[model samples]
Target: MDDLALSVRTARPEDAADLARIYIESWQDTYAGVISHTLLGAMSPRTHTTRWQATIRTMEKHSGTVLVAEDARFGAVGLCSLGKARDGGCGYDGEVYTLYVDPAFLGRGAGRALLTGAFEAFKDRKLRSCLIWAHAQNNACFFYEAMGGRRVATRTTRLLGELTPEIGFGWKRLAARKPARPMQSRSDQS
Candidate 1:
């Protein structure tokens, strides 16, 4: 659907459920073959709901920010989390912990809105640079590259008892991010 009636705003604890659904579904779709099947299959919306709730409630205390992309027709369709870098050696002072968009909205503007909003948040926080890690095998690595992010490092992390390679993408200038674009408009719906 073009003419996207979308808005980006701070995430609320009440968004836990919708965020959890998006997280679970997006993980399943994006990491099926990249991550262990056992790990991907074990993801639960209920568990993620609790995680999202705690993350939202304690974000301010941690100087973290969460942003959601809401569409008039789809409610909360995308989300992003930004905060101080978790890895001390990442060289970036800020990090995007998570960014996910509903599969139905993937080709739309939700993902870009969430990411750009996160960059804006980082700049607002006076963070020098920002980093995000993705499974080395995930195609989203290309997305990060397309967004002016450079691969700064690589690391291995244990997930579901399997060691997986993760690549860190960094943006040295958060303020350099381009303005987000709206979803493409169409005259007909498929």
Candidate 2:
């Protein structure tokens, strides 16, 4: 898996459908046991595509970026959305809003590549630190821990009538950290 070739680049409007597929698939794969079945069943890729398309259209070039990772055989296997911290009180300068990889591509480098790409983007914006949130019960939460993130906070949020506990992981000195792969320029597309 370490030798697999993967590419990461800025996501465009044309990539919405693929991104939505990856997003919903990854969510279903990761949150099946941790989240309510009713809520998971309610996720609509069509609705998400519209939201994603709107996001791409409204993003300020320097403020945030959405990057997609593609395998040589599979296109748009993973994605990551990054930007300013949603809550200014979090003490982190930037946030990884989301990161998801197709279930088939898990354990490969897609997730790492997307994450590395996001960090590079944060560094490009001169951000010093970043944070990401994941459901505490999600098995993939260990991926964050393995990447050197330290648990900084935790909160319970309501989702589909159920309270879900989430853990926040933070990484400081991002500019000093090396990316897992060389991040492609904004002009690069999968």
> Best-fitting candidate, measured by lDDT?
1
Q: Against the unseen true structure, what C-alpha lDDT does each candidate score? A: 0.83, 0.81
RMSD of 2: 4.5
Worst 10 residues of 1 by lDDT: 181-190
TM-score for predicted model 1 compared with the true structure: 0.89
Q: lDDT per residue, candidate 2, 1-190, as tens digits?
A: 3344688899998899898888888877887877777788888989999989988777656488899888666678888898888867289999998899899878766777877788888888888799998888886589888787889999998655678998999997774444465344323545
Tell me how many residue pairs clash in candidate 1.
0
> Model 2 off-target regions past 4 Å?
175-190
Off by over 4 Å in 1: 1-3, 183-190
User: Which clashing pairs does model 1 show?
Assistant: none
Model 2: per-residue Cα lDDT at residue 14: 83
My TM-score estimates for the predictions, one after another, are: 0.89, 0.87
RMSDs, each prediction? 3.2, 4.5
Error of 2 at 145 (Å): 1.3
* Model 2: pairs clashing at backbone N, Cα or C within 3 Å: none
